[model samples]
Target: MAKLFLLLFTLLNSSFLFSQENTLGNEYCQIQLISTEKSPSVNPPIKNLDKEQVTLLEIPAGKSRLRLNCRLDEQGVFTFGNDEILDVSWEALEVKLVPLAASSPSFLLPTGTFSIDFVFLTHHNYKQNFVWEPIVTFLNASLLNNITMGVFYGLCLTLILYVFFMGRVVGDTRFQFYSLYVFCAATFFLLQEGQLNIFLQQQSFLLSHQFYLLFAGFTVFTAIVFIVRLTDLNTTWPKLTRYGLEFGAVVVLLMSVLMLFLNHNELSALLGSAMARVTLLLMLGILTLVSIQAYRNVQSAKLVLLSLVLMVIAMVFRTVLHDVNPFLQRYSLIIAFAVEAFMLAVAVSERIKSIQTDKILAESQANTDALCNVLNRRGWDKKVNEILSEQKIKGGVICLLYIDLDNFKQINDKWGHDTGDKVLKVVSDIIRNQLRSIDSIGRVGGDEFVALGIFYDRTEAENLVIRIQKRLQAVSLHIDKQKTVEVSASVGHVIYEEPPKGAEVMLSQADQSMYQIKRASKQG
Candidate 1:
């Protein structure tokens, strides 16, 4: 009984203090008129900055009972200037203070009771304190809300566009996935920040709360999945990352459903807020580590780091300063999230480029002959055209050669094609060993071969041919009857200032020259 009495006494004292603070004994205007411009990106009335005076309410001096003074700054923020701390330059103004009562009385001062229509009468209970009111039309609340929503819309759109462009350019699966996830997150954030649920024609408490619960839950889950994929964490720490993601998803999903059934509204709200903060912190830690690891080793890892930094900054503004100024707080998060999305998109693009490079290398190796480890005919043709196109600007000369084994058929008929193949392999090896790195060789036919090189003069080209022939002679062969088999080549060469109109033209020229060499050797 004593404890209950003490608690009651304490409550009474607190109530007394609150009542004293809210008292309005003598009817005097304690006016707090605020005039501020909508920050940006919305449908807002253009504030006439030049208008230094505000005609709040017109009334005859003799009929006015109370007065309060205020002034507008350059940015249009109004400050109370009736007190001693008069920071703003006050402009003399008249205003009407109407009462909402039926009794009317007259006095020396403008003290006659006036009547006005009463609107919403909000009351705050002691236990559940209400800090804000539903905006009144007289306060330009709609305009401010519109401006705030507009900024979020523009920011989200920008982020989506950036993510798409970066994903396309990078061509990486992870980056594309990152872009997609960011786009979804931005869309969800835009909806939540805009408070659009309040404006729905058929708004219901259940539907509104459910939408927010699902949207937030899915956003958190999606962000986690995207980060894991983007950082290749699943590959690096497959077991842990995979299990954690799955566990988190399941927990959030269950909580989402539970919130719908919960009787404790405040408890549900607190839990949701706590979970959101925890998820955000965990994501930040994981992303930070991944980004740092990437930056330490990979050339393209900076994009991830940049994205992480941007996200952290955005969350700071959103989680920390949400109540300061709706415009600044909201825009800061929007811009930061958009920037982070762009960076992640860049990271994804780099991954795509790496994949493409690997593909090209694999293709090149595939088209090469394993025996000689040189390009086969197909490879040669592809590389030659590509090289030609690349060097066209430099305007260089090229020498093409066709070399045929003089008695290659006889060797194969006497000894098997296996021996012949060995001989061909040896010859290909020796030719390759003697040629410069810039030169290319291809086995175009059974006994015919093609060589390509950039040359300054015919002397240099002929010298290369002589070197190949000498090396071929030095290479020994094994036959059934003899320890050695003689091998020689009939060589033909052609020079082109530019690539031939057709490959056939170059081949014909080289073939004719090879026949001429054969005839000359026969005559000798």
Candidate 2:
């Protein structure tokens, strides 16, 4: 009986020691990670783990999954830092958390020589802090990052909407392309910064990553197009701009297709980043060349060049120090983009203003007579119609004067065409000087001119015509040192207090009356 009691007591003591050794409590613990690549399940047994192949790691206070070879018999809160309770899975031995606050929750674990595996979903430097410090720091950084990105996106959205509306209003293709580029770049930054994942409930990291690449590709493509169009590269550097835009199109298509098949793996991420960098370099090179070529002649191109230079510098800095400063790496591009958008907006405005000015100048040139710098026949007709319409409405008298230079062909044949041209110019100057500023005068044909004047009565019209006829007759052209030639004009007038059938009828009546005066003058 004594031996049996001793044996039972020894067995119970040994069981208690074994249980104590297997239990894990609320303390800092190191874990071993095993890649279960060949295992049928992630929860492989400890017996399958090779001690030499396992890597030891400390647990972090963020979302992570782990496979442990031990089991938890008691339910306890698994805390990472302060008050945050991480989602723990005993069956799979996984903990997922986003440590928003500072607190570490205790976990009671049954210990054994178990295979454990951990995967962190958030990026953090493990050696920076031991407990909740890292989590707090990361959360703070993330908050700041989100705030900065949100403000940037808001500004970009405003610029995008403004440019889109302006593009429609101005009917400029360059504005449309620039707006598209801004939108794509804004979306790319949002995805790259994970803003979409936070705001859009349905968005995943993988989807955002894929879309980041897609918009990045489109942004480059559209930027190339915008530059080409804005600088008039098709006219300035035709072959190079054509080929560059074509290549950009192909790259865009290739990247878009690649996005469809991307799985968001490390290799894909690396390749996408490399492609983006290469595209950026290409764009910078092209823009630099274009800017240099156009800076002297194109004011808008200078602004565009400045914008590109700023963006390229920012991009190069980000690329160089991306691993060093997380905040700059993530947000520098957005800052650069904001500044560039402002500069580009100014460029677009200036370009539109230039276009409007040129259009007005072209219309003026189209309406003016080249020789006498007065209204041409087309302009005269337009003015006469306006006067007739005004007379009909306001009950005013308007007189149409049709004047022809007498024996003009004889003057041209005897004294030469140069003398005849001088005589016509002198006659135009006399008519212009005699008429009121409100009157319209035009050289309708060779040696034939018409004037429209407002008057109070028919006597006033007759007096004005007689004055113009006497002034034109007084004109003389010096053909050479030895001789001078004189010229005279036959004038006819028509007065209307009501709207005529049309300008054509008034013009025809004036022409017949002028021919009658010419015939009487010849007979006399």
Candidate 3:
């Protein structure tokens, strides 16, 4: 039983090895090429001959038509010396070939000799190599290409959706322009890579080529707009921004007109690519300059600068290093673009944060007194209104001390405005020091100030008022080496068990009491 089992296992292993060898042999086939002076539609001279009569032919450059003889044991897909792939029918005696354009011819084959006539739409200066493989190999290659293209498009679409929603949320035109730029860029790449051809089965080669140029033009145009808006280039780099915008607009217009009117030819394609590249360089230069100028003041500009630099490096690598690995060359731009989009998103978020901070600071400045760096009348009114509202709910005793500097005009006239300003700052500091953190103080007039605080009773309010008066009396300002100015203040106190209905009404009542004390002091 053991010997029989070993014998069966050995036979099975041998069979498997033999099958693998046969499969590999069938997968790879030999092809021979013969250039002919005859037109692509004409049959070559060696069709009726046996396999020995067919000589090994070398395919030379710049020839329009060639005869390709390939031997196959089974049906297979074959790629010609050019990049064109076609399906072969074993049963059909004659094969029909199609060319890229009207002037080109199709690759047609006859079954018996295993021979086909190949045509070229464009002449190449280098030698041509043909690929012959089983149909399964072709399918595998197609699947791989589909996966790569799908990943690229997926990333681009995600960025588009993200930026589109963010643009609407932030109400920023720059984000909108960036999203448009990304869409155009993705479309351009899809057309360039031939991924769109798979989906648009009815699209003609001419229309596809034209759409590629159109999207490329718009990509550069929108990128310029995005950078200009992001950096405020019109205001910061006026001359450069003006020139960049004009150049980008001209390039886009030329591409659009060319796509509509011009014939699809090598010359037109070259011109379109050249114009697009030049516009990209111009945009990069403008962004680099703007970033350098603004980076010191704007933190977000640093990220923008880094993204631009990364993109420029990727572009340079793709253009200059043509001999690099094919897979790396194909994906370098996609990777660079993804990194750049992420950085730009971060920069936009940072810009929004900065704007919010500036708004808060501006509000604070509007309500603050510039001279004393304390609350102005407007700020004090708002603060008192908040307090009054709170007191209405939780009724408590509140005290308002209205204080006025006596003979302030006389002191200002004698010592000059500079010394008068210094004296006011001293008074403001003294008032701030005397008040609790919860209390509020404001400058309502040139020489009048108000202090608001919570007190338990009339005795506590009177004690607080006396303390403030004593501090004001002790304050003195030195105007010069020869002179010192001293000032006195008249105080009026208003105590409320329940706060007034409005901050304005409370201020009015306090002002009247202050004037009564001022008049009585003048009489004394």
Best by lDDT: 3
Where's the lowest-lDDT run of ten residues in candidate 3?
81-90
Candidate 3 segments whose C-alpha is farther than 4 A from its true place: 1-5, 8-12, 29-176, 186-207, 257-271, 280-284, 287-302, 350-354, 381-400, 452-470, 477-484, 493-501
Candidate 2 per-residue lDDT over residues 1-524, each given as its tens digit: 99999999999999998777665332223333333223323432333222212222433433445453433333212223211111223333344322222112223333333333434332222311112122344456557766777788888888888877877876777788888988888877765555444444433444343555677777777888887788777677788777766476557647665855765355554555567556866776677766775666666778788788888778765656555554465457778889999888888888878877887899878878888778888888888889987887776688988999888999889878887787777778888999989888998899899999877777887788888878775566565566587778898878877678998999999899889988988899
Query: Roughly what TM-score does model 2 have, to 2 decimal places?
Result: 0.68
Q: List clash counts for every candidate, in order.
A: 2, 7, 2
Give Cα-based local distance difference scores for all models.
0.56, 0.65, 0.66
Per-residue lDDT over 404-514 for candidate 1, one digit per residue giving the tens place of the 0 to 100 score: 888889989987787888788877876777788989888878888778887666678778877765665434556555648788888788877775665667778988988
Order the numbered candidates by TM-score, best leading: 2, 3, 1
lDDT of 1 at 423: 80
The RMSD of every model to the true structure, in order and in angstroms, is 17.3, 12.7, 8.0
TM-score of each: 0.50, 0.68, 0.68
Model 1 residue 462 distance off true place after TM-score fit, in angstroms: 14
